[model samples]
Target: MEIVKNRFLKGVTVVLSALLVISLMGCGQKTDAKTTEAKTVSENVKRMPDEMTKVNLGLPSNKNMSYLPFYVALKKGNFQKHNLNVNLSVVQGGVLALRGLQSGDFQIISSLPESVITGASEGANVKLIGTLDIQSMYSIYVAKDIHDPKELKGKVAASMVPGNGTDIQLQYWLKKHGLEPNKDIRIINAGDNAERLQTLQQGQSAVTILSPPTDLKADELGYKRFLMRDELKTYNHNMIAASGDQIKNKPEVIYAFMAAEAEAVTFIKDKANRDEVIKIVMEQMEMKNADAEKSLDFVLPALADHGKINIEGIKWAIDMVKEAGVLKKEINLDKLLDERFYAK
Candidate 1:
């Protein structure tokens, strides 16, 4: 009787162990099923157009107005409309932005036409796709005491840097006014708008080239506007550019980006949207409303209308850079202007 009782207890123990294992297995299966369901649900929803193309776009921090269209497109959902995943990076200046383009850090860069031309001449395989502004909103502000560019001769004239757009303008301005670059005038590399402003304030430099916001500030501080030659009869203050390889391989992506910007341009040009435009520009630039408003008014006329590429503006830029002796080779105009993606 004792042996029989012991065997019965062992059997009962085995049965309980088996039941416990089965219960644990059931719970595990349910958990896996729920996880699978969640994954399927996540996969079913559309995922930002599957990142059809990736782009790194570069802009300068100084030209808050020049980047207004980009900000509008981002805030207003134009980029998503065209199905593009573009990453826009704010840089110190247009020259640095162009450098990012050269190193393949960014696929598209907004810079002065002169920088692009100078880069192409230096063997960087890049081309201009479209423009943001095609006229002169820039001015040379000399110390109120200095009267003329000829007076600027032999005095220290400061700009961001050589090969930079503003510097190119300075060079062109001096040349037009019959001042030789190195001989007739002394051009120094002043760091940026802030540096230029400081140099002018301290009287370290007699003249400096400045764009909007800073330019207006310079004017308020009593810096005199020296010349307005409008070197570019057809000027592009800001442009979109990419490598030749990108144009060939990812033309569709490039076109999509241009299309989004075109929509932004339209919204910005409409005076009815002035408040909205100022809000976007100010927020993106982290600037005051008053400053942003002044810059917008200054650059509005120069801004490209919707998606239109002003061929004349491009020609003017090319001509100015050529005269500055920045370009070593002839720019193929047809190869440069690619506006097929913009809506008619």
Candidate 2:
């Protein structure tokens, strides 16, 4: 009787051990399945497409190479890749572009820092979000007869609308050369690139600021080009701005637009994309191969690093605006700039 009891107890203990092993194996399988499921869900979320968003972007001029990054973004589908359908509006001048931005006609505008500073100072709820080009794309072009900067004194200088990028650069250049902007050399809102070139050709203005292909055209017309010094090159010539409402409300849209722009800048800087970039310039600006190549070469170095806004450059622009008498009081950098959307 004792031996039978011992055998039965041993059998019971063996069965219990087997059952426990099976249960542990089942738990391990379940945990493995859950981990796999969780990983797949995370991957699906990452691959999910962003809802398409339409964005109206205002530019001073589409024909100029300064806005090349935007054109590249559009042509290369960078904006669409980021789920942004960006529409371009040629608003003629930065001041008018900002006005369009204020009136709700445009959600964003690319213009000179001066326009932003002046507009923000005058109660326009706008912020400089990013810059397309950090350096000035402009060169002072003079009529065939005028050879010296001093000779430009008392002469009319063709520029875009007052407070435009070209206007600000022209004033800064003139001031640096000991020539006062309005007092010594008269600066007029002559018009866009072609119009300014016509003004110079018609002798309406003795000197005017010209960027790429237009400067090349000026050269062909026997006009002399005066390259600005490195100091003036630091000016934030082409900056992207948005209203306070847009920055506050639709931040995702801003991020998408900036991501596209930054990609475009990267694309432009890559030498492997040289032919493609030139093709874009030709198609957008309506230029020939050689002219487009030359324009691209001229404007390539001016592109901002991943569309990053230059705070020091902004400070310099503010001081320059104050000196230009466009802004009466100082502008707070924090209020005037919102760089959160710019990807490094």
Candidate 3:
């Protein structure tokens, strides 16, 4: 009777062990299924293309080194990396660029802070997002025979469209030297940098304001170049601006664009990447190595801190426009500038 009882307990133990083994196998199979599922999901995510936002960026001119960060961002694929399909359109002047932005022809614009301020004061719905150069990138280049600002009196000064940043700066500079713009020096719309340079060469104008490689070209031609920032200082020269609708409706796109611009500015400021940057400048602006190097040297220090806007600079620009009689009334800073996108 004892042997039979022992046999029954052994049989029960065998049955329980088999049941446990089956349950463990089932768990293993479930675990393997979950791991496979996770891997498949990850692979699909990797294969899917990122949704790119298309943006049109308008600029007064691309020939100047002031726009180098944008060029770098485009050439280095920084915009693409941030999922932006950016298209750059070069207009003749800041006013035209702003007009394009207002007309919905451009999603963003790089223009003078003064232009944005003036536009805002005039009921235009635009806001400054970021700045490229905190200091003025312009320099007054005179004919080879001219020595002083007074020498430019009764002579034509070549400029972009009236109310453009260059034209406004020229007027301010002339006024500082006791030379009224229209009376002492006649300012004319002589097209872009290259065309303005041609005007000087062809004897159509005696003085003009220019930036970068164009200034270098002017220097080579024996033109006397006077730096605008030497005295004017802290003017918001080139700024990134967008419409109010863009700021209100597409905040994420604006942030992405600023992120790409910040990255580009960082890449440009690095000394280790000097040669590559110079190469990019040469390719974009069609400049020689020496000219590119000189232009880069002049512009590198003037770039804003990671494309961030300068409040003091913007204020200075506003005052300048008011003094120049370009801006008639006071502008509200809160309405003119939207810092949320680039606050980081």
Candidate 4:
């Protein structure tokens, strides 16, 4: 409470200082360039006491490389503009992330809709309110010695925990090649993105799915790109979601957070902001100039159209998950969405 009060006070001081600076500038007294830049930044942050919503945003992934919008919202001060104070926490997998949400530890999770779908079908009552990136950014990487998906047959491969999106993707890809996942190839339980990449690099797994930056790096190091994510023609990838009752009690928080995210999305898609967004990505993902450019090229178009959920993609993903045995009984996506928070 004291911290909030102090921040609110600081915000007020910042605003007042800006007005004074403007007054001085109008009087033909030159303002310091550095001070002007500082004040300009301060005005973009919200400081209202009632609206300083604290959020425990869950990121099951280890890094923000995959969730670029959230990273932009944080780095570019979009969250603060909406008075959202975010505390981001990372766990190993979506299962642990959903567990956190169920136990009241997470206000919202940035994950795959498949994760929320799996959780909701099991009586969890979580729903994806909005999608961030609408398509699966994941591309398949194979060992240097392998050329095609078929070549991976009877080879050691890596998979995410069973019933997750990656698992489903692996199954779908193999079935397309007339191969059963478990019988035709050995899928090891690689822990996370880093683990899977290491498994592939160490020759432990012949094939694995990786999203951008990592996938870009894999390509740089001579791994074969078996397939691209967009080739699937179907995806319901990264999304933002919260529990039903939790959202009901504090709808404003969710709304403000979504608004900030949408703002970031706009910033990401604008051509004028291209250089700035790419610079941020380079710093955040620790990518070189070329890889960062490649990443922005790959993901920007695939970002949700103004952060709206793709009902078609969501439905397709649900059907695929059901076929994979992740969901016992099918449930309508309408029952799994609280559409009030995101831009509809």
Top-scoring candidate (lDDT): 3
| Residues 1-344, model 2: lDDT tens digits | 99999999999999999999999999999999999999997555322126887889998776878888888988889989988888998876788899999888888899878888988988998999899887777788888888788888889999887765577778888888899878998888887888999999998999888887678888878888888635474667789999888877777788788888998999999999999998998888899999888889888888888788767788888887787677976679887988777764
Give the TM-scores of the predictions, in the order they appear: 0.77, 0.82, 0.81, 0.82
On a 0 to 100 scale, what is the lDDT of residue 117 in model 1? 72
Number of clashing pairs, model 1? 2
Off by over 4 Å in 1: 1-52, 92-96, 226-232
lDDT of 1 by residue, 133-202 (tens): 7776678888878876678777777876675668778787778878888787778887878788889898
Collision count for each candidate, in order: 2, 0, 0, 0
Candidate lDDT values, in order = 0.76, 0.83, 0.85, 0.80
Cα-based lDDT at residue 342, candidate 1: 51
Give lDDT: candidate 2, residue 142: 87
lDDT for model 3, please: 0.85
Please give me the total number of clashing residue pairs in predicted model 3: 0
Model 1 scores a C-alpha lDDT of 0.76
Residue 320 lDDT, candidate 3, scale 0-100: 75
